[model samples]
Target: MTVLDDSTAPGLVGPPHSHGPRRDPAPLLPDPEPVRILGTPAAKTFDAELQRDLYRRLVLGRRFNQQATTLTRQGRLAVYPASTGQEACQITAAMVLREVDWLFPSYRDTLAVVARGVRPLDALTLMRGHAHSGYDPYEHRIAPLSTPLATQAPHAVGLAHAARLRAATDPAAAEDLVALALVGDGGTSEGDFHEALNFAGVLGAPVVFLVQNNGYAISVPLASQSAAPSLAHKAVGYGIAGRLVDGNDALAMHSVLSAAVEHARSGRGPVLVEAVTYRLDAHTNADDATRYRSAAEVDAWRARDPLTLLEGHLRAAGLLDDAGVAAAAKAAEVLAGEIRAQFDNPPDPDPDSLFTHVYARPTSQLREQAAELAARLDADADAALAAATDAEDEAR
Candidate 1:
């Protein structure tokens, strides 16, 4: 015993070194080929009503993107990130959620926000340079359109985890509350994305992450983003399930997102979905897409447009005819007209609004700054009035 070698030592070679238990990676892995339902035989079995509704929404979403981009050009919006080619992912993400559920959208997801019952104009408030978010987040259970990359991911996880904890004590209060966060493929490279996944997996939070992999993140293409087989594959590392769907196929997006929402609502933890899509337009009105990608590439994605795909499927299934197509287009035009009418009469800027929501309780420095600004505005107004009075008297 005193002459025991390293191999025979109790501490050095203890029981072949077992590390608890190993988890099966197969269940977490995503399908090699993205799931397709629009052109597949599965389309025939999908609900007729749901297919019609999805088609309608996809058409409306596309028109919304076009109108919003036009607004940016006309100076109505400070900036607009059009979800043109990715309308299927945008609309389906909103449609799958319940009223009790929450949606966290990226800056480019205005279509999703509006589809979730938020007013179309309200969805563009931030892009219009408004100081506050356009709509009441509580009313819609939708978070403000997040401008920072991957920041919304953690917020979605935290809210879902808190809801799960609360549901543990008050069973009915849970209502199977789930949170769905939308992120661009570029966001996947962020540290916040990684941390959120880790936390979500460890806590078994009821959250779903939908990554709209629209080829390029701004000017950087997906090839430069990550070398992972697919963005969904990243979920396996966090012990969560992963899914890949044809982002341009409305039916596929609807099916995948619905399943993901149900999976999370059942307290099965988080799911990461990668929707292979393309951003037909530039990243934003400010970016020149031609600088990075070719014209042929954009045209190729345009051929697989979400609206076109859904519309084709619906027509083939006899769910949509000439009249139905006309009706959907008419509704979309009405929405576009409403948005334009609202922008025609711009809201007057309120100087006080600058400090309104900055803090719950203003700090001393903030109060001082506010006072200084107010005094300056008052003085300027008084000077203008005096000058006007003098001009009037001289004319008399």
Candidate 2:
């Protein structure tokens, strides 16, 4: 498939109806299907096709995460963190937007990145330790995945703020621009989180913070991260709208996210959605979760796997059959093989290339260091460069 380019969004064409009021506006149902979906809606509310697509995306994303984790164990990656319970939170939110919307993903939001049209193996490029991976974010309107937990939140706010400036610069250019940010529950502990919310709140920036509350930060549980009972409530302190959703239920996640994105795109300021999810795997490749958690707990959460639940829903909807499922599996397998090949076929960085991009102009310190290091080995610059390479390899 063609990776989306700059021309794909804003002016791109889709079903004309895509721009209209979304879904049904019927009064919300009662407690039996409580609105807190993953509470059920009092009644079925999504279009059949929309429901099916959500199902497919969730299935593909979950399987992708599972396979990537498996690959990590098989030595195909340097590290991997399974977004096992958070696929619904991502796919649902992404399904509602145009390519014009901006996505700021955390390291674990691999699914949303894929849903936004990033290639699968390309998604794994980061884990493969490539200098870069994934297509250009400017074309797709996706910011590079943020490794530091809460940093992306403010950056999303900044992007939305910039969008507003752009829209104001030309009245004819104003359009509905949405900014979506996905961060894990542990990220709430950082000051950047609070600052970002306050910035958006004050400016009424078109931004949304999708909090995948996966219940654990590495070995540290929620209790150790923050004293708040609900991460959504953090928005109240910032004077913004907050919604709590069941992250495990794909349908409910989509519904809530659709509403949130619409609100932001219409310039209604910001929204904070707390997706109550669980981490069914260790934090990353380096950690042994079994040491800090119980096997019983692990088994119990496995039973709540988002993939399995969504698969059951699809089968019930008569949308997924053996052939369809088989096709998706085959496609993912082929993509995985390609990813493995790319990782195996390595590229060597030029010894001098790093210095070329180190600055727009080489700083005095770097120039002196390069010159001194070059002279120490009797002008065989390769010797100094080789020594540096050895040091990096040793540190690793």
Candidate 3:
């Protein structure tokens, strides 16, 4: 049944010695440094670049979220969600992915979107209830942000499946692309999450489910989300590997996400990562955290704050020197100025666009209404102009 080809396979294109005295693939990866609780051994990756990046990224994300929240409150935005303390989960995980990988983010994943190069202004379109969002996600390797809880997980699975198909067909597109879908802790309670997990596992889809464990689903805490001790353990039901990382630690997050991406590329199936972090802000512009939670609890979580922990490690390692920290702070100040400038003078609506875009040919009812409105407006304008002219003639 072999249709033999004289030509060798593309990857096998090497001189006869390319295989060079076969060696067992060195252990897939060196054993990773163990997780640290608070400050045990510091997780080994707390070096200069990692520390600086972690600190600046958290600061940048926080400032951006705060500015966006202010924009919403000032009636400039329709709505907004702050990633807030979950910056570690978003920014560092974005660093773990190659530009070719796809990200399916939720409404709250604006920082992750920014990390992947989506502009902050574009994110506001969706929240502002625009007819169409301004962001072209495919151009940025991001899918549209899903507001429907856990639904995007399956879309991530579908994207991975599509990548697998292309890899099998086109040599040019063969590098396996891992698709990541970020979801909230409450989202995992949906049936869609289970279905996506089982399907991705069965198909060996290169996908990662990043659960941002911000401790609550609005007012409900993780205690009520699921009975599993940790959400990552849910991977067991699908016979996939999973890990729980201190989501507040960017270095630890990157270490785990890099491993998960490698595992998925090797066709090991999807990996579930439960990132343990907290949401310092309300679920959105509408929700009130104080209504459901006590001040002590918020202050307590803030004490183990992600930014403070990263700053401590940075100063300890001499990566974030006082000068560098000052530079980052000033840069953030500039960024705030830019966001304010944009919010002050935003895009104007094309009023008649309501009937122009939805269908190439207008429906009968829409056409009739549009014509009536246009004529009525024209008649009113004519009457106003005539009245003005009459007043001028009398004055003359």
lDDT of each: 0.91, 0.77, 0.81
What TM-score, computed on C-alpha atoms, does each candidate reach?
Answer: 0.93, 0.80, 0.83
Q: List the lowest-lDDT window of 10 residues for candidate 2.
A: 25-34
**Cα lDDT of model 3 by residue, 214-309, tens digit:** 999999988877898678878877767767888887778877888888888778778888888899999898999998888999999897678788
Q: Report the C-alpha displacement of residue 149, candidate 1, in angstroms.
A: 0.5
| TM-score of candidate 1 to 2 decimals | 0.93
Which has the higher TM-score value, candidate number 1 or candidate number 2?
1
- How does candidate 2 score on lDDT? 0.77
Per-residue lDDT tens digits for candidate 1, residues 197-302, read 9999989999999999998889999999999999999999999999999999888899999999999999888999999999999889999999999999888888
Which residue runs does candidate 3 get wrong by more than 4 Å?
Answer: 1-34, 42-45, 352-396
Which ranges of candidate 2 are over 4 A from the true structure? 1-43, 132-135, 364-396
Q: What ranking emerges by lDDT with the best candidate at the front? A: 1, 3, 2
- Top candidate on TM-score is 1
Kindly indicate the candidate among 2 and 3 with the higher lDDT.
Answer: 3
Q: What is the lDDT of residue 128 in candidate 3?
A: 69
Order the numbered candidates by TM-score, best leading. 1, 3, 2
